[model samples]
Each structure stands twice: as C-alpha cells, then as structure tokens.
Target: MDLTIHQNCPSCGAPIELHEADRLIRCPYCEVKNFMVSRGVLRFVLPDRAPENIERSEMFYAPYLRFKGNIYYCKGKHQKYKVVDTTQQGMNARALPPSLGLRPQAMPVSLVTEEIQGTFLRQTVKAKTLLERAALLTVIDSEKIKAPFYHRAYIGESLSCIYLPLYIKDEILYDAVTNKPLASGGSAENMRKSGSGYHPTWTPHFLATLCPQCGDALTGEHDSLILSCHNCHSSWAEQQGKFHSIDWSCVVSAETSMYYLPFWKIRVRSTAFGLETFADFLRITNQPLVIQEKHTEMDLVFWVPSFKLRPSTFLRMGKNITLRQAKIPDGEPKMVQRMHPVTLQRKEAIQSLKSILAGAALNKKKLLPLLPDLSFQPMSTELIYLPFSDKGHDFVQEQTGISLAKSVLHFGRKL
Candidate 1:
C-alpha cells in the first residue's frame, strides 16, 4: 500500500504531497513554510498568527503616558500617534559584520518608557522604565556568517535596542492577603508575628530565564523572588532561601523593542563513501563493500520581517500576493535569497527556533541540514507587545482586542 498525504502551504495556500525523506518542505503557493514529521507522539503545533495585539494605533505618542527612561523622544520616529521605525534593508544581510566587508548595518538607540509596580514577599517594588532588545547582527548571507569572528565592525551591523511593553498578572496564595507565608502554613501564634512579609506569585507575560542545572522551567514569583522549577524534587531555593540566577530577568528591560531579526534555514545533502580494508595471514576472506558519499547543494530561506500593507496597524486581508505585498513602508529585504514563511505564535515560534538550535548543538549537526527537523514552517509575523500603562491602558483588554482583530483579518487579504 502507498501512503500519500496532501499538505497545503499555510501562508499562500499551495497544494503539496508528503515525501519520505523530505524533512523540510516549502509550499509552491505563497511561500509559507512547514516542517515534516515521520513518526512518534508528535506534540505542539505552531500558530498561524501572532496572539498579541498591534495596539491598533491607540497607543499614541503621549507625553503623559511616557516614562522617564523611554527612548522614543530621542531615538524612534513618531508617525501620527504611533512611534515608528522602518528597516530599509533585510535584517539578515545586515547581520553580516561590516568589519568583514559583508554588508552595511545600522544601529539605532531606543526610546519609550513605562512604570512597573508590584509587591513581592510583602515588600513593594517600584520603578519606571522602557524595555529594550539586544543589538544583533543583521547579515546578508546568514548561511555564510555562522560565527562572529567573520564579521568586521560589530557595531554597525548590530541593532541598537527596542523598548517594548508587557503585562503582568499576579496571584497570592497565602492564607491572607496581608499575612506572610509563615502565617499561611504556620501555627496561630505565627499570625501574631510582626515584621512578616507577604508571599505572592508573579506571572509575567513573557518568560526570560530557565534553570541551568535541571533545565527545569522557571517563572518570576515576585519582583524579587522566582519560582525556578516545577518539579518538586528540583532545588529552587538557594542557601538564602531564594531562587538562583533570577537576576537574569533584567535582560527584558523597558528598552526592549520588537525587531526584524533575520535568520537562515539551511538544507544539506550528504552521501557516504569508501570502505575499511583488513589484511590477514591465514584463510584470507574477501569482502565486497564500497562506500559512496554525495553532498547536495544547500538550500536556504531567509527569515524576513512581516508587516501589514494597510495603513491600519493590523493585517486586514490577502490569501495571495507577491513577495512585495506584506511589508511596512520602506521595509528591508531578508538577507537570504530563498525562504519559506510560517505563521506561528510568538512564544511557540521562539521555542521551536530554540529547539532547533539546541538540538543541532547536541547532535553535532549544522542548522542547514537540520531544517527539516524543525517542527513548524516559517511565516511573516510581528513580534509585538501588549503595551501596558499604569495610568490608562489595561493589558488584558488590549490583548483581547488584538486577538479578535487578528482572527477576523488574517484570511481576508489580497496577495
């Protein structure tokens, strides 16, 4: 019996057939890509769209809404009410080091701010700031520039930073909102104790750190405390009775921005060759075995930036269009020549990408050959923030609005 499964491109709606050794597959339709699976209890499917909101242009440039550390006034462009920045070249190509004479790069500073306030361990933590993303290399040939040593001047190719916004929801599990953790699980006498601090669990919109020892997942329990491991046997608390390595969460500061980071998916084909020969004195036996190795040319797809062509902050329509269709004004091209786009939730997309990198490291394989091993295909999607303001906006409500708008507008566009 022959087993043939019909598959369609998630982005452009192209018809495709499943192939046995074809781990990485691209759609002929819209260039939306996907991964292949041969067996096992496969879990997790990549989303077709980003789950967060684009702010629908409601978040205007308001001095009253700005925080002290915002990079907006000095760094970004103000378009109407929204703060805007556009990329003229492909981020992938810009990743190349200018010092190496690979490509030209631009490094921009950040501007935006928000106030963060919350209680962790009965103590109040208050601060005002914006979020920023690390400066990264944007290369034209993502496949060629795998190592940093190849780049010339690192400064030019790297991006400055983006200050994005996030929402945080918290829950208190203690016996009383005013009582300390000792009071919740302690004797009645503990309730009368003085100078006791309340214990609360904090859940942030995005995750930034992980436990190094067991690779167990972690979450911020409070402004100062972190719930490191979900496994009970795991050691989360240090000698100081606090989670270790949690200070790393500071990486996602208010200066963080949504960027058009570039990446390359590579494909390599190889064959085996030659044979081992042995010489013996008695009863010489002859063996016939020849090894052959064939290396196939690498195929690549550069991950590029995706923006709605409409004036609206959200994507309104299109089932099919050319490569020039879904882009922001004066947008840049991806560094890599060929690429497959996949639409995935922000969280899942990052996770899947990380998994590919990690798996490649452990398996001693290059990413180019591991393209087919990826769980989801690539898509042009935005990495955006829910944007929170202690003064006016509720992140929850904003996220809900964004989700509703995306579902309605995703499939309604023209190519």
Candidate 2:
C-alpha cells in the first residue's frame, strides 16, 4: 500500500514525502528536521483516480477508521490476547462498504490536506464500537457470548481516519477510484440527500525540535516518541501537542557499551490492593523468596519496555523486568547515544499494567478475584536506560539477568 504522506517543511516550505510511521520530518532542501505532532487520530485519503471532469470541491467520499494494535482481554480465569490490524466504515452509511477490506494494503494513501475539498462522509460511528468489533472479527474461536468479560485493553494502538474516493454519476453511486458500482443507496441522488458532508477543519501540525531547557537541537529516530538533548542530557515526551521534559536517568558504567534500551519505570497506587511495597508484591504474587524487612521499605515499580514487540516477547520482558526491579539502582544524569527509538508511549504501556500483573501472579485462583477489584493508578513514572552486554545471539543486562535476543530487537523495529 502507498503509505507515503506529504507535508511542507517548516524551515524551507519544501514538500517532503514520508512513510506513515514517520513522525520526524526531514527536509532535504533546508537540511532541517522537525517533529510532527497531532492532538487526535491521524487522517489519510486514498489516491483518487476519477475522471478529470469531476469537480474536486463537489465530489463525495466515504470515511473508514483504520485500527492496528495489540489487543488484551481478561475473560473468566484466564487472560487472552491477539495482534489485530483491520479497518471498518466510520459511519452508519449503508450505501457504502461496511469495511475497507484490503484496499489500504493494496494501494497508496496520502495525508488529507485542506487543499482537497469534497463531501467527506461524516463519522457518526463511534470509535469504541469499531474497537469492539475488531476483536470479534479476528477471534481464536467463534467465541460464544460468555458475558462478564471484566477487562479489555488495547496497547500500541495506531488509529487513523482513511477516506475512500467516491462519486455519483447518472443517479448511481460509484467508486471514484476504481469506477466500480457501490452498494450505497438505491441511487446517486438519494445518497447526496441522505449523506451529510463533512468539512475539513484539522490539519497535521508540526513542532520545531529544540530543547526546552538548553538551546540545543533535539535528536531522535524517525518514529521516536521520546527525543533527547545531548547538550543538556534531558529527555522529552509529547503530551497534547506540547513537549514536556521527562524524569529520566541512565545506569552508566565506566566501560564502553553498544546501545541502551529505554524502559518505563512506573509506580502504581491501588486502593483495593496492597501493592505499594516490594513486601506487598511478594505476598500478592506468592513468590518463593523470603520477604526481608528491607523489602517493606523498597517501593515496587513496574518496568515496561518503551518499544513495540511481539505479544509473547512483550509480556515476557515486562514480567521479568518488573520482578527484578529492586536490583536496579538509582542512575546518573548522563547522556547516551546508540539507543532504540521509543515507539510505544506511556499511555500504551499502562494498558499492559493488568496483563503484567496477571502474568506475574503465581496463583491465579487468588489473583483472579482481586483482578476485578484491583485498580492500578500510576503514581509516578520515570524513563530509564539500562546498559546491556551484547552476546553473539542475545543482549544481557547482567544486573537484573534480563536477556533479549538480538533477533527480537531487529524484529521489534518492524512492529
């Protein structure tokens, strides 16, 4: 599929085309880089192939919501999940196709700009409705209605509004791009009367990448959610289109290293569960290790990777790191290079809170009932980089015994 999106460089006003996954825009003409920020879900449109006679302003289009994410659901005594990637119509228009099918993967798409004016179909369908439907569409079994599914969460979610080209000719609805007859309305005239036109009000917004504390240029990969400044040794994350400094530290050693992987260190407060201290965790999860007096003073922190990976690997890494969190010491305020991009955000990492808790539990019978009442509210969050010793096949963090396959690192980048 053509996922190339075009945007004008803020420095030189030169048109630059980028992949859909790219957030950092680089302008070749001006040799400047800026980060793109969006307050809501990103938007895109399919390439139009209509005849030249059609007026661009008067044309009609259909809206589809595209969802690509990892799904986690807690049902009965067990937790289940799947990696889902699908799309559905964004409105209740019966005249158009219910789903976008494989069209987005088959062809190219562009960012919907103010330059294109058309009767963009109104998105009356709620995104929550589609999110529920996507899970059922890709199920392990034709799951029967067993009710009372206590928890459901989506992580690493990539939501976008995709517009399909459409038009009316001779009182009949037709796909403007493929010229195939569509199922929308009995006739073209009926669709125009029934369908409400949507006015384009939002455009993609970009921000200059500069350190808030120091007058230094921020550096990060194309899809990085966290950008850092080497001069000031500061890290930044975006919240509602604004960049904010993050509480970050690095476990630096005197020896040379290859790369540092970022992780989210989260401390959660629960009114129903006693999860504040390491002693509480030992009792809750029923660990074999003896709980010492020091364990009560040590606060428990959930360590989640700040990058995407396969579901199994993601869960394993999170569970293992969290279990040995006490082994990690207070880090130094130092700058580091050769780091993996933070593809996953703090919001997405929090979705795995329950899943990681469930995974860490030794006795499900005791923990299952508590899962319904347990509410994990993040009291504090910090970004930390851990040094890993590179083996030929895997990278090992000797302090915590956290080992990640080199192959897994390469595979995660694609996700």
Best by TM-score: 2
lDDT of 1: 0.22
Best candidate, lDDT: 2
> Candidate 2 overall Cα lDDT vs. reference?
0.79
Candidate 1 residues lying further than 4 Å off, grouped into runs, are 1-350, 353-415
TM-score for each model: 0.16, 0.92
Q: Give residue 109's error in model 2 in angstroms.
A: 1.1
Any runs in candidate 2 off by more than 4 Å, and if so which? Answer: 137-148, 183-190, 193-201
Question: What tens-digit string does per-residue lDDT give for candidate 1 at 202-273?
Answer: 211122334556665543212111133334222222322223431111111132231111122212121211
User: Listing every candidate in turn, what is its Cα RMSD in Å to the true structure after a full C-alpha superposition?
Assistant: 28.5, 2.4
**Each prediction's Cα lDDT score?**
0.22, 0.79
Q: On residues 84-179, what C-alpha lDDT tens digit does candidate 2 reach at each position?
A: 888888877667788888878777677777677776666777888888787775354426535346566788878889988887666567788788
